[model samples]
Target: MKNDFEEKMADIMIGEAVTALLDEGVAIGWAVLTERLRLAIENETDENRVRAGLRAIEEVRREMHTRASERTGLPRVEDRSAHKLH
Candidate 1:
């Protein structure tokens, strides 16, 4: 019975971790989308498309920043070295 309970608890913890990871991934994806959208809007000749894309990108960027802030409490450290110029 004790082993069974432990296994169940472990499963629950693992599930929670997976969910958090997925949320973090989604946040990161939004950041990437924002950058790509910005590039596309800059190169776009159609004024309507440019305006719409800018609006969309701004929304996505806001969401990404919010999600990123939410995930900041997670147990992880930033790898500053990876972003440093050589």
Candidate 2:
């Protein structure tokens, strides 16, 4: 059986996917929310909200890393070129 941490991480990964799905023109009836997410990425004027969104995104990414480690039994490659000869 998967460890609790691994299971939580997998759930977070799925949540992140759902968030991304909603981000791509899902029309959640709140443009501000989406704009905030965009502004978070683009570093908009609202630093506090931007920071919050960034934190949320970062948390999801961390969870994804954990889940990937569990599912793939590997870490993500920072440089795929290392796998190939240039």
lDDT of each: 0.56, 0.52
Q: Candidate 2: which stretches are off by over 4 Å? A: 1-20, 23-40, 75-86
Off by over 4 Å in 1: 1-28, 73-86
After superposition on all C-alphas, the RMSD of every candidate to the true structure, in Å, is: 18.2, 10.3
RMSD of 1: 18.2
- What lDDT is obtained when candidate 2 is compared to the true structure? 0.52
Candidate 1 C-alpha lDDT tens digits along 1-86: 75555445434433443455567775435555556566665777876556566566655655666667568853212444566698
**Clash count, one per candidate:** 0, 0
Model 1 alpha-carbon miss at residue 66, Å: 1.5
Tens digits of per-residue lDDT for model 2, 1-86: 43454455444444554576577866442343444445445845654444545554555555556677678866555444566787
The all-Cα superposition gives candidate 2 an RMSD in Å to the true structure of: 10.3
